[model samples]
Target: MLWAGTAKADYRDSIAVLRIGLVETHVAATDPIKLEAIEHAFSGALGIPVEIIKLGSYAALIDAHASGRVGYAIHSARSFAATEAACGCVRAFRSPVAADGSTGFRSVLVARDSVTLPVAELKVGYSSEASISGWQIPHQAMRAGSLDLPKLVRAGSVGSVIELYQAGEIDGFFGWLPDVPGDAGSDPERLFGGWNRAAIETADPVRIIWSSQRIPYGPHAANRSLPDDLVEALGAFLDQMAVSAPGLLDIFEPVYGGGYVTPDPEEYHNIRGLVEALSDRKSAARIP
Candidate 1:
């Protein structure tokens, strides 16, 4: 029986195999290839045979982590908080730096050039109700005014939502804007880059009307049920990768930068609070 994450030096000697859970993200389509590289890098570096488990959703991944079916997982800070709150999974390390050499990302509300902000009501698109960047954070920002979530179209992914908006299928869409330079601070234009920037510069432009608070980089979380020795070893291996094998970290979808670091629980304090607040709001709204 392979009791995952219990090996010492030569993992082959133990019946245990290292099972790594990858959080499915916008880049999920390429997970198999990325995870293959990850398996090779980690197995070679740590002498442990690794098995990669790709989960389809954050909720599914979190449930698996809580049940011990997953030994470790990659997740956004919001997901990390939720997992910790639910199953005591703790952050093993911070993800590599993103584009713009920052460790944080932001969410934005974008619309066709014809649309403007503070419009009383218009069709809006969201990735999913559970998405931190696509829904939760953006929803919190919208709640500051007359924006009502129920009126928002629940598009499946950031790309899909943006597509609907571009096609004039929706008025605006909430989506993640990666690599927002921390130095840019609250500058709206600087924060809008990548495809959004392209749209802004092109003939048919898009407007970034709202930007969410900076979200800390995602984290690598370890299940609490794993042995202490294995946990320490995993951390050590990650630290080694941060220094010695950074390219392998491309699997994490870091937009701008790369390199792991010890995660500070304090880094996620604000995000956790925001998530809790949103949860409370949802529960309250559900009371009929």
Candidate 2:
């Protein structure tokens, strides 16, 4: 946990020793299992333990990385945005696959199967405004599809939206991801069905329609506080792990690709557009 160095280092070695931030998992470098597997993959190559650091929420984790307490963050979409924009201490790593891998998350519009109606005929209830899938992606889809959601679906908290959906309070529910909102993965807690199920699962009978294109995946950003040379060295280390410890990589699933790539915002062009347009909409609504 403190520092893992089984042997002395040589200048010729491509790996640079460093620790992984907590919240990854509790496991020893000699043996990293399941989701915690990433901890030691970095450890073995870097020739160090990569202390595991844990945080409370996405916001807390971003704060830690931005402050330079951690070298990098494998994080969700918006929090990553807030971190880069605020501290400039972090940069994203290019990923091979999106979080959910490739196709990414999709937006789902739900309605009671008991009713046969056009999207315009039903009042739609959407998840939390703070969420990308709940509010952001749906909003974008509405605009792009030339549908006026504000006039049809009511925007509210996620729980409220679900309640409305079941109550017949709203004719339909607008949810991102039939999977997750933009650049996010499934929350087994928030999502239900078989272990293999995806997106908007529920105890109630609700029919859904595709509302938007697939959402993008996100990256774990490196700390800008590190020296450029060290960053480059770390990247090399990750590249090696892709092949050397692919089994470990497999456990992380959808999170890590073959190896680290340059984290670019352009990979998430649609997400960026959604954020900008949403910001503008909220700002406009605030105007007197």
Candidate 3:
């Protein structure tokens, strides 16, 4: 039976029947039967009865997590950050690595030519304030660096941002580059994302002038209220699945097929800060 009840008196006891929560938006593309099979496989691997709970929205999932109604959750980076800010009661044990050997992507300022201008003097095009790579991450990075803010032009879309840069309307545009850790942007094989495509196709040479810290992929996190042993078992199961059970790995995380790895405690620090800042802004806006 699906467990959607309120938090138990002792959250530790709730793990008797492990419940994994995910939002419908995250799994809407997957088949229900496959999800059921995945649940069964997870139960077998972890040696416990596992139920996959699908919430209507992230808000509900966050509330459920905060209340200890859900022991574990599959969260997008933003949602995970919001959850962390809400309760400080969960920890991400494992995060997916991209097939390209990247843990995540970084927001970068790609210029038509080598940029020698001060950040405040350069006109940079961004897709929108809502875009993580195009505006939010890069904007936060600039503020953290104590650099004077650049002249940000809203281009509405990545394509438009590229066009504005090409037309000389903006000196550069905010885009993303794969976060391959040690490997700099020199490796042609590691290139990914829309901006990389623009750099390749455009006749003019484009160079990445600035980049933000790696923004990790969404993580599979567990509520700290659960028993430590349980969390470790779940982490082990996922971490080893790419080799022991490739099919289940594909079913569980189709997009990032490289496998799961233990998350660096600081992996989501920047994102959490960003979420808290945004939350504060909204709260301030709501005040009279």
Model 2 TM:
0.58
Model 1, span 81-142: residue lDDT tens:
87777756565454656546666767777666676545447678887886877777766655
Worst 10 residues of 1 by lDDT: 184-193
By TM-score, highest first, what's the ranking? 3, 1, 2
State how far residue 210 of model 2 sits from its true place (Å): 6.8
**All candidates' lDDT scores?**
0.66, 0.58, 0.79
Per-prediction TM-score: 0.64, 0.58, 0.86
lDDT of 3 at 61: 87
Error of 3 at 85 (Å): 1.6
Best prediction by TM-score: 3
Q: For candidate 3, what's the RMSD?
A: 6.2
Name the lDDT value of residue 86 in candidate 1.
71
lDDT of 3 by residue, 162-257 (tens): 677667788877778777667774432232454346444563566776777788888999998888878888888998899998988887887888
RMSD of 2: 8.5
Any idea how many clashes model 3 has? Answer: 0
